[model samples]
Target: MAPSTRRAYATGERSFTCYCQSMNRSPWPASSDLVEDYVTHLFNTGIASSTLSVYLSAIARYHVMHNWPDPTQSARLKAILEGARRMNGVHQDQRLPITPDLLRQLHSRLHLTSNQHIDQRMFGAAFTLAHHFLLRVSEYTSISPARFNPDATLCLDDVHYDRTMLRCTIKQSKTDQRRNGVTLTMQRAESPFVHDVCTGYSEIRRLLYPANFPFFMHASGRFLTRSDVTEALKKCLPDSCDRMRYSSHSFRIGGATAAAADGQPVDAICKKGRWKSASFQRYIRPFPNT
Candidate 1:
């Protein structure tokens, strides 16, 4: 929770304290129906579900710490959780990657229709780099312009020019096993479309973020969050499109799907994605109808 959320929780605690004092009674036990009612009140007042979950989890821990004998409280909480789960409804199915034609349509709208000459251009460059180069989102942030050595052959500066042979050392990836690990090297294959995107991203990196800092920083000079990237992609997509269902993780999915379509081996795709085990084969199973 944010500071305001924490403050609201504190205010509720103060009210509970005052109520207990007025009644000349000790704090309510977890088994008390009153505590359960308070949780419902919090939910009714439009508190975020994640915030409420945190508060309830803390309350549960406090009860456990105090050695409260509250079998009834546990039962009540279970019922409340089940009710909330039902009310929230079933989750939507995962949206697959936007096809190449749809992706081109999105690009046209963002590049031509909108007056996004500067920010949108940079945004387009980022996603294009992600989609085309199979670069992990973190790779952009982990790389730094300052890391470009005088030798020019060891860093991003060296290989970015030859699009066919681009390489950068990924220090920590989503699947890196060791606390400290060797760097990952990625090379662009034979697509001209992919080549242009990587070339454009190199230029955009210098234009948007400081050459002295991380490769992908915001206008405020802070490193971009994965959510920030998703929001930008959302804007680039058409209004009629349900691209809000897409996330930064979708970039990886898009890459995997594209590679799979290109007849890349499942093992190779898994290695690129840094999956720990072949169990990810579950995701590769074709839909029954498809």
Candidate 2:
């Protein structure tokens, strides 16, 4: 699983474990009825609907993994999900993506022009890849520095490439399925820029670590964590800025949004992103119509 996904699973597991412990019960050997009871208990205790939803979803997954039936199929489960309504005092607000101009400004703040620094090099690679390739942080992190040629160029072997055209073969995706492969033919203005950022990132890693090291690592020399990337983004941008949610996955969104704005075909964008289905359109939502 990707780091972000791992974090979510960890959080869910912690919540489930805590809830079970608080009830003076070991949930490890729980049955479907116990899961349903837990979901009901959450609602009766006035837990927030969204939070209860997360907890329930996690429990459901746990049950499914154990070959137990889902709570939703049970009468108690259905009631917990749909019968109870939110209190009038609570309002669920939908969040929106950051605007393009703000993103551009954020990008500028992250990549300084004259002086070069280690942190800058790290963020620059992350920001540039997200800006162009619509890459998930996982995709960037999955790439090993050793994969690059001696000149620091991506060998273009993972995907087929002509003199100016490239076809990316995504063997595995976030959804845990193999994509049918994608081809990208960069325009004159874009290819050089993408190549330079990728090369510089490889060089930075090579300078800091011995040959055959992971592409990105912490001061402790372990691979960089999702939190590391988030902290770097937060540090690079202004303290007061709140227009963007700015998770590592934002890079994937930024890529899709930029491609859509530039009039790339939706089919091409979908292939490059390795979205298993159109359901992913929900994640990108509507890009700047301009």
Candidate 3:
């Protein structure tokens, strides 16, 4: 499991332990009734239905590890989850897509220069790459500067460019379960924007970083976090653009959307995005359904 998964599971365990202590009940081998009441307690505290399920999972994991039956399998507990979910509908924070036009606007506003520790060339390179390659921010950026994984995050060594093409080899992705990696090739784009920004960032990157360091390092000499990416994106939003409606994900969404609007084949879009199934269809939005 990813480190993030382990941390979430640990948090769930802590919540279960605290609730059991307050109720004067044993947390081990939780009875179905106790678990049901626990869900109710969380729901009453304004916990989302989705989070309620995570807490139940923590309780279930404890039982399984101690050679006990999974109390979460109880039909009554499942019914309670279903009822709560129906009562409190799922909330989706659907961010707006950053289409090609919006991307250009973002780039135009940035200050690109060679003297700064970080600047527009960095943002331009990241945005353009994500737009063309359909990358998840996590695949290219460090979640926290202190927690960067050299093997997983995009390092300078993973990229190569020639006069006409760029090739990026990702060591792993969220869906690459076997740890078998992938290499994506992008030809020289018809528009010069992509090539110029990427090569510019590359040149600056080599000057500041050794071959092993991350491609988008921060001015603080740390890896750029997702928060860093979001804040930069928000700052350069075209006037009147709602900052909340756009995020790091906008690049991927916009890339897929732009391709679709241009009449690119669904399969080609899927392949370019490295999507294994039609789930990529959900990535297309604000564009008409066909």
Candidate 4:
């Protein structure tokens, strides 16, 4: 299994084990009836249907790996899962997109001071890069404190810039299970705000880091994590409500939504976002109050 898949399954299995322990039930060779009951319990806890499905998958994988009968495969359990979906609803809580107007506002409002100039510049560059490249947080920042594989992480050398274009190579991605990488290029936007921020960031980063260091870094010289990026973004947002609705994922969703609003074709958006399927439609939210 891929590292990402393994991590997800590990999380699901841990959740299952905790549930079994709380209920005084054995999870290793769980019965169909017990599995169904657990599914219902999880639904009652307000987990989305998609999350419940992942939990079930984890349970199935565990049973297969342990050479036990997979209770989740029972027809009765399947019906119970289907019923859980109907009862709980499948709609996911999506993050609000950060549109171009919002991006410009953040850029203008987040001013630099002598005391923290480097930090502000880093955040500005990181934010602009994420929006321009339609990047997931994990694509540009590390999630773990431990050392990451070069094949799965973005290093400083992955970025290349020319007179009019900025190109970034993603070493690996969730969609690229084969470990084959992809390159994304961003030309100077007509507004120049994003381009200017990115260029300033690159110049600052060159002074602070070695060639092979991770591209996104904190003031302390550590690689920026997802939480770090999110907190920085919150500081840039104008209000508490916008801060609450936005997250690292807002960059990708916002870019896709903005492109759609500009009348860009679906295929073009998918290509730029590196999505292999029509699932990109899910990211194109209607503008607020429209």
Q: Using Cα atoms with residue i matched to residue i, what is each candidate's TM-score against the true structure? A: 0.52, 0.54, 0.69, 0.72
TM-score of predicted model 1?
A: 0.52
Off by over 4 Å in 3: 1-93, 112-118, 287-290
- The true-versus-predicted C-alpha distance at residue 149 of model 2, in Å, is 24
Candidate 2 deviation (Cα RMSD): 7.3
1-290 in candidate 3: lDDT tens per residue?
Answer: 23564476689889987899999998886888888888889888889866776666666666766778878878888788778878888666487778887888788777632345366678778888988888888788885876678778888888888778888888876556445778888777655677767877887788787778787886667777777788888878876787778899889998988888889998889877878777687778783211
Sorted by TM-score (best first), the order is 4, 3, 2, 1
Which has the greatest TM-score? Answer: 4
Give one digit per residue, the lDDT tens place, for model 4 in 51-140: 787788788877766788878878988788778767766686568888887877677655631146777777777778888778877787
Each prediction's number of clashing residue pairs: 0, 0, 0, 0
Cα shift from native, residue 148, model 4 (Å): 4.9
Instruction: State in Å the error of residue 129, model 1.
Output: 2.8
The TM-score obtained by model 3 is: 0.69
lDDT of 2 by residue, 50-129 (tens): 67656665666566667766554566666656666544144323333334554555556765421445556666665665
For model 4, state the Cα shift of residue 237 in Å.
1.0
Q: How many backbone clashes does candidate 1 have?
A: 0
